[model samples]
Target: MPITEKEVRKIAQLARISIDDKDICSYEDQLNKILAFVDEMKAVETEGIIPLAHPSEETQKLRSDKVSEKNQRESYQSVAPTTENGLYLVPQVIE
Candidate 1:
């Protein structure tokens, strides 16, 4: 069903949008066209069509998972104010 001008005005009011009086007819026409297009799309036949994640049939290129950096945890944590069992200690903020 096509959207009426009164519905368009109500929608603008509900959304708290301030539309010009001349623009209300334009919005009503645009919304009606969109609804008509949706109705047209609903009539298409798709009995056995499969949904697709992507339009193209290409696989992603992945690199091998490997460690590329040396461990620097102890070197970095050495400057912290407090640490116990390799964990930095922070003052409790909540009870």
Candidate 2:
């Protein structure tokens, strides 16, 4: 389907774009080429190829689930400028 100026205008309006007369011609050619590419792609035959997330044939490494030592919060909070009841104090930024 060839992209029309009217269709471009309608799409631009929907997208809140401000395309002028000079840019419309350039955009029209671009859109027509993209539509032509899609038209060509529709002719290809794909019978058995499966669509996949990753193109490579490799499995991800698995890790064994085990309980680990938790991080020491008291040690980490020592770096903060101010702390009260295990909470970091921050300056008020909002009204």
Angstrom error of the Cα, residue 14, model 2: value is 1.3
Q: Give the clash count for model 1.
A: 0
lDDT of 1: 0.88
TM-scores of the models, in the order given? 0.42, 0.44
Model 1: per-residue lDDT, tens digit, 1-95? 67898999898999999889999889989989888888887788978998776888878888789888899989889999999988999999789
Candidate 1 residue 33 C-alpha distance from true site, Å: 1.0
* CA-lDDT, candidates in order: 0.88, 0.89
Return model 1's CA RMSD, one decimal.
Answer: 11.9
Off by over 4 Å in 1: 44-95
- What's the TM for model 1? 0.42
Candidate 1 residue pairs in backbone clash: none
- Tens-digit lDDT track for model 2 on 2-95? 9899999999999999998899989989999989988986687878877687887888888779758697899999999999999999888798
